[model samples]
Target chain A: MRLPRARGPLTERLVACLQRPPRSHVALARTDGRDAADDALALWILHELHYRGFEDVDDAWEWAPSLMSMRHHLERELEERLRAEYSRSEGSRSGQAGGDEDVVAVLHQLIEADDGPSLADHLLRDGTTEQACQLLRQRSVYHLKEADPTAWVVPRVVGRAKAALMEIQYDEYGAGHHDRVHQDLFAHGLAAAGLSADYGHYVDEARLPILEQNNALSLFGLQRRLRGAALGHFAAFEATSSLPSRTLARALRRLGLPDEMAAYYDEHVEADAAHEQVALRDVCAVLVADEPHLREDVLFGAWACLELEARTARDLLDHWAAA
Target chain B: MAVEEPDVRPAGDGPLRCRPCPGGPLLVRGAAQVQGDDGTWHDTTRPVTAVCRCGASALRPWCDGTHKVLSQRGVNPIE
Candidate 1:
């Protein structure tokens, strides 16, 4: 988690500023159309401070006003890009779909309509060991702390939604068993695959799309206004996870890896299948049914999850193909 | 019981020869073993196989791409 190697000017300056005490007026401007690797990783590092600060960077930088302001600017740019990419629908769904009927039906429609290519299939069928390793590295950003993002919504939601979310998160946390927790399982997977299990070990090597995917969850989870979206995001994730996890497990085994090496994916193959029903039914459906207004935001959250995942999949597949 | 070493032979030409599951109608090509319902097992050397990840595949322990459709719809089977 030490400060990653700088990608370009933005990261270089940002990393330098982080090394010292936060400055009040550090220039935060960036030119347009710069290599995404440069900008996105830099932004990711700033965001990472909020999660697990780099090994070399001082912990004080997490709340430093200057660092926060710099991160704010980058986030604004990222948000603008996201807005341009994702158009809000003019449907009757409420901004806060707090009702049951609206949440389940809308979430179902959203899940049904997702037609993206299967990253799991590609991994199961043709993934090389190197590619799988890279995939784990990119995913380490979020998988290392799997359920924390949605946990942000626990207090923001009420009644059934809150209860349902807690129920799902309880399983995500291994129901009080530390070894069974998703994050720990992922770390174990990393170690079994001969990669670093220490958190944030792969920050410097990860691409922009990967960072953006994790950032979306963090963004929605931290903002109270986006609570419905956060629910939608989690719902979409659980719904789509089971088969992919199974495929990934097969892929790992194909590479002569042991069951422990495939433990993370194997665990998800079962866990997410049940989670899908709970998310769509108890969590989303109940929330929307009660609120009745946040349907579109719910769909928006689901779509954003799909869109980001699609981008990540395309990027990883393309990189592997090129290599 | 002690583990026995798998029989290895020189490659012959015929679709890169794979080991068929002894307990079911499944083919696997990799360095792994699949145990069947009758307590029999087969070792495979093929580089790839469609093992069933979902317990419900009509073709038990062999992938028939059923997971593809299920995943696209975001249906969690564990539930």
Candidate 2:
């Protein structure tokens, strides 16, 4: 995919910098920190450098030091913002997980206690086609590359955790069947919906929340220090997916959208049921056992996942309401 | 026509290990085929599969995570 239309000074500079050859001291764009779009888009582009590089950009730019400096700057800001939000969301509860607490139990409690807004519930109840399609576009930012962000944790972990992660990932990657791969299924869904099936097809139209959500996963996955958080976030994601996926499947059928697109959710309804059990019990629990110090980070990561999703839901719902 | 019947379960001594999740479904591994509620053998598809013990699942044999809503056990079903 080509670079998305630049959103601000940062992305504008990034778009231009990619056109040049590998350099040591290219000037990078700076943000005032208040505008999330400028920073989020810049960070998203930088993160993309590590994933599938843009068709137009030189691949050599990925390892350039100057770009790494820029990535670090944006990441620091993003991590700080995420940490603060996690803290604020904790408000009254004894925010920290006890060192000796059962990791799976804590994970279940963390996921169970979450009361965030449900986009699927809304789509199931009274969502219009416009709203549902809007949601599909927003979600494509991540679903198109599902399970990829968490794959980075494989190398960062060892012992049962690593093996357990692969056990879940095997199913996620279609268990050796290319046709069942989650990413391709989502691409098929996009095409069936009459939307673009290309990777990052709607990046240009992605809102601040969507970009930030993508950036958050990239940050956690790319940084070795955040492996616990990465797995935690993944557990939260899988744990919540099964039921909502069923709701979404019914919602899509109700709206008369193509059955092919709804079938993607139908697959998740069953897949995630098995995945959720293994993700929490085998992966996250084992990771915490191997490295007990990461327990809090796991909890924080789960919280961040829910928090970011809630923000995205609010942003889209509010936008739709206003429109 | 007396023909010898062949074994249909997963080959080797790899036992079909199953774990029951608290307030959730029974997770089964290494099963080539499973008997559904109607007593028909359905081919298992994934490396690991969730069998709906709660019986509230729309998917019948496979768990759709409806146990969470049945006994108020796991993630609350509705918003």
Candidate 3:
């Protein structure tokens, strides 16, 4: 819950300024835009204020104009970069099929086109204990607060979409049972695996790609204008989760981890299988059906989700390979 | 002497519905239990549950999303 160690000059300046009062005139360092690690860390810190504020930092800083301006600058850069990359890869692809096309089929084709290597497959087949723990540490950054990003969309939607999203979220929130909350289940899994189960425990150790992944979810969720993208990202996530989660659960059991750890994955196997249908058919399909203009943004969000995940997967795999 | 009761309850005035997805599972939106091939009943735990239609699921009576993979790989299990 404390401010994490600074990754670069930007974060250093941001953290130091955060130590002071919100209204105090503290000058922030200019970012060179080349140090992505520093940029991502700074953005992550700013986003964290909206989630759970750091222990010694005043809550008023969450809305401080200077900080808000800096956040906007960083978000613009991130959004531009994501769109550029999307366009680069999207050029050779076919044109956007209209609202009349089956959105669910388009989503499936998008998923199938993702030729990224499977990190889950490696883990399931022959991952070592150290490798398993490394994955858990990195994944803790997002899994600890799972489903919260998409929860932001509930208020932004209406009618069939809202009702369907709530139905899926109800299960994610444990369906009226405290113990069944997905985030708590991951926390329990972490504890059983001998890792620190505290929220934000692994934020300090997170790499740039991991931070960017978290920032992307926050970016899509926090902005009301990006509601279509948020649902798209959520749909892509659920579509990809079930099978990978099954593999992950098998890897956990193979590593001889505690039953609770594996049980978390087991829960996702069936849960996400159903969620995939609801997210794509009921949520995204219905939303686009009502608001035809958002179809492209929805597709962009889905593409961005897979692209960011592929980058993170490759980063982890390359690191493990080099070691 | 004790009276025996049947497992089936009379249909009540509830809005329970079962909708089958093409090439996928049957989505049931209420309190329901699926009797497996082994004769064991599995209770639905979520707000909506996917009852496996493609028999290729690892989790019996519940869809594990294997049908998508199968369909993509040219297996065409549903058809």
Candidate 4:
């Protein structure tokens, strides 16, 4: 949690600013280097302040306006890059209705037609321990605080949708059992695998795509305008999580890790399966049923989830293959 | 050493039998059991039920084809 080593000038300057008292306004001049390099790390650090602040940095810096401004600049650049990289198609727009069709059906089509590169396949079939560890590191950025991003949607939903979210979140929070919380469980997995369980330990090593994935959640969650998107995001995540968790468990077992080490994934295998129904039928369906207007935003949330994840998967797999 | 009670109820069909209730059929494909709000187990006597192998299915104690999707997508753990 100590401030990670500066990857480039952006991080170098940001880190220096963070070490001091919070300022009302500070400007970060744009850098021409690749977005994935130093800018990503710097932006990730800014976002990380909202979670567990860096161990060495002042906690007050979490609310610093100057830091916020700098972070915004980096985020703007990252968003522009992402929009340029992926094009939206009309077929992808099929779920944009506030009509009578079940949102789950639309989600199913999205899942069925997704031809995105398979990170899970590679991990289960042939990933080396080094590569697996790297994947875990990138994921640890979020899994260490699992469910927190989606928690933002709780206040945004009501009645059945709110109740359904609480039911699913209760399990994610381990139902008042600290040891059973999903985030803690993930930490155990990380520790068992010999990786650092401390928050943001690998931020320095994480590339832009990984950072961007987490940033998307924060982006959707923090905005009242994107509440529908947040719900859709959670639905997509829960809907898609079960099989990958099972595969991750198997991959860990294949590598000869103990059952305890695989317990996190094992838990997800049961938890998310049940969650999918609640998410699809009770949560997303009910939310759309009530709001009607958020159908498009919800679908966008789901699509964004898939898009960012695909990019992260491609980035990791491509790097691993090259290595 | 303390021993754990075996919940090995047989899935009754031919030789398969429910462990707890000797005459009761073993729970398997097409059959489901739901734990009610009061924690009572209720048998769902449907002809074809989707079973969850993936832990993510929200209708716990019930299969919903999520595991199949995960497997077909090559995201199943055994892959």
lDDT of candidate model 1 versus the reference: 0.70
What part of the reference interface contacts, as a 0 to 1 fraction, does candidate 4 reproduce?
A: 0.06
Q: Which residue pairs overlap in candidate 3's backbone?
A: none
Tens digits of per-residue lDDT, candidate 1, A36-95, equal: 678777777877787778778888878877777667776677766775565653222332
Tens digit per residue, CA lDDT, model 4, A180-299: 888988888888777889877777777778778888787777667778878888888887777777778888788776666688887776666557667777788898889888887777
Cα displacement (angstroms), candidate 4, residue A140, comes to 1.1
Candidates in order, TM-scores: namely: 0.76, 0.93, 0.94, 0.79
Q: Stretches of candidate 3 above 4 Å error?
A: A29-33, A95-100, B1-14
Which residue runs of candidate 4 sit more than 4 Å off their true CA positions? A31-34, A76-87, A96-100, B1-67, B70-79
Q: Which parts of model 2 are misplaced by more than 4 Å?
A: A29-34, A91-99, B1-14, B73-79
Q: What DockQ results do all the predictions give, each relative to the true complex?
A: 0.03, 0.73, 0.70, 0.08
Q: Could you give candidate 2's per-residue lDDT for residues A179-198 as a string of tens digits?
A: 99998898898899999889
Could you tell me which 10 consecutive residues in candidate 1 chain A have the lowest summed lDDT? Answer: A89-98
Q: Write the per-residue lDDT of candidate 4 for residues B1-79, one digit (tens) a residue.
A: 1111222222334332221111111223223454533455655332222233344344444443354555566664422
CA lDDT of each prediction against the hidden true structure:
0.70, 0.83, 0.84, 0.70
Error of 4 at A207 (Å): 2.3
Candidate topping DockQ: 2
User: Which of candidates 3 and 4 reaches a greater lDDT?
Assistant: 3
